[model samples]
Target: MGSEGIMKDVTKQGKATVLALGKAFPHQLVMQEYLVDGYFRDTNCDNPELKAKLARLCKTTTVKTRYVVMSEDILKKYPELAVEGTSTIKQRLEICNEAVTQMAIEASRACIKKWGGSLSGITHLVYVSSSEARLPGGDLYLAKGLGLSPETQRIMLYFAGCSGGVAGLRVAKDIAENNPGSRVLLATSETTIIGFKPPSLDRPYDLVGVALFGDGAGAIMIGSNPILETERPLFELHTAVQEFLPNTEKKIDGRLTEEGISFRLARELPQIIEDNVEGFCDKLMGVVGFQNKEYNKLFWAVHPGGPAILNHIEKRLDLLPDKLDASRRALMDYGNASSNTIVYVLEYMIEERLKNIKNDQEDHEWGLILAFGPGITFEGILARNLCA
Candidate 1:
């Protein structure tokens, strides 16, 4: 379809909104230098001088530290558990489930309370996660704990990796659209701490996995007016588009390893995104009936997958140098919170953008929410700016 045809199809409607959002972050900060040096020490590279060089590469004052569930002292207490080979399957599952449950509940409750909603209003619980997994997964636990409808439909989209948030939102939208009166509560909780394998230093890209990542959770409530209403809704869902590159599955893959789950970051990822982003975005805009230049006031709720991925997106999209400041700050403050990174970006916008919005009628604002992950896929959403 032509540009006008695309814009006509994807323009905003007046319903289906983000009623509320909430997030939880751990207290600890894993400094990049410390993490890099830890990896260098573990690798025992023949070139001693390379440690400083690698440290400088990973170091970023913009992302000074990352949060973790386990403290240094706590990790010291269970040295055997830190290694990949020492822990039994049951032990690993139990520990990870416990940590994820706690973080999920903390963030979920904060979100529900902030939005002034309750379990009674929720008809569905959807969770998106990649770091760890279990049956009856995190969403089931949330429904039970919150005393939500036992009949509440549970949808768990696991293993989508960093891009899970965008995909999850799409799933939630589908659910809400199908079940008109139902409100869907979406939560993304990741504990990379549980997947820590101290011996991954043999592979250079594996080093990137170990040095980056933190524990956190974020929750958002989405629904039609039939489900609920909010005095200050974040935004109405306009349209969403998702695309996957053919034969490029290896570009980004996360899977279970003996040490836990690990992510493979192929060096070719930057080039892959650079080559496809323009066309991918063009088609996405077609879905929403707009052009790239028309949607220039973008509040990039980008998944801070890694420094390299973010840099690649910046150059390919021709974004300003400081365009990803919020995402970069989140990486520095929280490391990569997986699906929660975009939530943190939304949080940042709430803090900064909400303040300046004129609380008046007839002022509909717009922005794009974008994220990418495994399948070498990309997802984009056109949203009516609630904060603006």
Candidate 2:
């Protein structure tokens, strides 16, 4: 960690910048109305109460559609996946191993293509996923699939939930900053479709997870320096903070069962974000050399966990009306893909910047990407336009 003269403990290593970003989703599309009305009804396995409750819960997320590795039609066609306690952990793991790896490879290909270079130049790989394939390390599969050099440094980060997305980026930032001429490939894939409407689980959390979480993969490249040949807008890392709040461990829980991992999400999560977000923002802004008057200049690329969480963060941070637009819109379009969500938000930001630049409008300079997970893990990245 070098020093920009901000805070001594916060590492200041080589400057890291985002060269490109790309996302991929399964071919199957599940609409909210169908999932809430038809799919849940079919999978609830005669539980009318669960179906009604799920419909109400899905509405709250404000998510219209989500991509899934297995479609509702496929779920209905396959008894093992649709029925309760039918598929063994081994079977489910096999399914996700292929689905998640393929998704990751697809997204990684997009990122590499955007970077416009050979994978031989990639120095390191950062892989993030909630899906725990039966195999020990899926990083080798990704590297092999992408034709990366066998000597590419591999750092594996799997099963961190939604927060893992930001966590992977943190690893990439460190690797890029600490090593010159470094190229870190950050990728995340989630196969949440396996957990969709599992009847062995209890109420509320299971239904909420079923209704809200979606399936997809996303990837991006982080470099020690920007790709000078490309005109891609640069996102430079300025601050990275990870805070584990006390006494909030039970707020969000993910446990393993015979069927799959069940999610136990408490209703107090939005309140938790509201309660502690200001302090998080304070730390980030101070480290980034932001003054009170400069707050408006900051854009937020937030994890669209749900509409409620986004709303709470917006209100707590006192951000502009449209500050959280990208998060909300991404959720609306793609649902919450857990660790894959932050990339969706970042993709949105990049797309917006590209649009503005093409239209000759002003591009945003400062931004913060935030993700919350099981530990009440509050992850934030203070970033700015690299050219600025």
Candidate 3:
């Protein structure tokens, strides 16, 4: 079928709209100013240079605090997790599977409550994670934990990195729009436990992970043709697109081994994304017949991969300073919870819009949600703010 034909058919019934959003974080909150001391002490690392480098990263990342699944109790229980060159994948998976599942259940329940719908009404589940590896995956565990219907259709996306949230939303949009009455609960959970390790010059990216990534889960309820009596539509999903830059696979790479997962990010990742984001976004907007729309006139929900990525995007698009307030606020409050970060950004946007509505202020109707992940993949979604 042709692209225009598919777009028409998809919107014939109605576009998928976000009904609600909720997020949850683990109990241990680490203050960035104190993270270096605790991290080094917990890992038994005495190298002053490595500690200094991490301290610098902590300040530069602009992350004030972050919640993590790892704690003194967990580190004490599984000392192997903090040891260098130790084969602790089994132990890591055990901790992460339980952590992610519980967080997912908590976030999902919050989302369902905000959605003002019975749990039984949800017909599908889309679970995304990059922190756990096990048989049956986190989806089955989440389904059981939430007491969802045994017949609920389930799809699990693993190792999607930072783009997993938007990727899952794209998947849920397809299911909701095509299946008529189907409502999808999209959940994303992540924990650094899977890749936690002692700071070493041999693996500089581990330090970056420590300074940036955090553990959390985010959930959103999605469905089309909302019943006005019960459902409140926040953002209408208009068009979604995914693309990858050529030969940039190595720029953002993660590998699973006996020691759990290890990630390596190139220094040029921010520059690479800045170079291509404009073209990618232009293409997505064109799909919805807004080819020449001004960028600043729309709301933005770009993933806060880090301070650098957000800065690069803001500059490249010539966006006003306030244009990325929600994104920056999410990063400051929660750090980058990988796939869960975008959910927090959207929630912040919604909350701000609600406040603005109360004060009789206006907001942009059209917005773009963007995220980058492994494979140098770019995910973009054009959405209309129904709440505005």
Residue 177, model 2, lDDT: 84
Comparing candidate 2 with candidate 3, which one achieves the higher TM-score? 3
User: lDDT (0-100) at residue 71 of candidate 3?
Assistant: 92
lDDT tens readout by residue for model 1, 1-388: 1112212222222356787888876666577667766554443344544555456556642466777776655456555555545644455566667777677778888888877755676778888877556776877886777677778889888888888887888888877666656677899888775566554336445546555677788888887552222335777777888999999898787667555666677878878877887786666566657676543455566778778877887887778766677788788778777788888877776665654565432322666777888888888777777664
TM-scores for every predicted model:
0.85, 0.90, 0.95
- Model 2 spans > 4 angstroms off: 1-13, 72-78, 199-201, 230-233, 292-294, 357-363
Itemize residue pairs with steric clashes in candidate 1. Answer: 6-289, 7-289, 10-288, 63-332
What TM-score does candidate 1 get on C-alpha atoms? Answer: 0.85
lDDT by residue for model 2 (1-388), tens:
1112112233334578788788899998888987856665556565677667877887887999999887655555565766665645666677788888899999999988887756766889999987865555778888998888888999888678889999888889999888766678899999885465454335555777777888999998887655464425368887799998998888888876677777777888999889988888777887767765355678888998888898888777677887888898899999999888888888777777777778887667887888999898999899986532
Superposed on all Cα atoms, the candidates' RMSDs to the truth, in angstroms, are 6.7, 5.0, 4.4
What local distance difference test score does each model get?
0.70, 0.79, 0.90
The TM-score obtained by model 2 is 0.90
Task: Please rank every candidate by TM-score, starting with the best.
Answer: 3, 2, 1
lDDT at residue 285 of model 1 (Cα atoms): 61
Error of 3 at 108 (Å): 0.3
Off by over 4 Å in 1: 1-14, 33-54, 60-62, 72-77, 84-89, 199-201, 226-230, 292-295, 355-364
Ranking by lDDT: 3, 2, 1
How do the residues 1-388 of candidate 3 rate in per-residue lDDT, one tens digit apiece?
1112222323357899999999898999989999999999999988988988998999999999899999999988999888789999989999999999999999999998898887678889999999998899899999999998899999999999999999999999999988877789999999999988888888876888899989999999998878766678999999999999999999998899999888899999999999999999898777756655378878999899999999999999999898899999999989999999999999889888888788887678888999999989999999999985
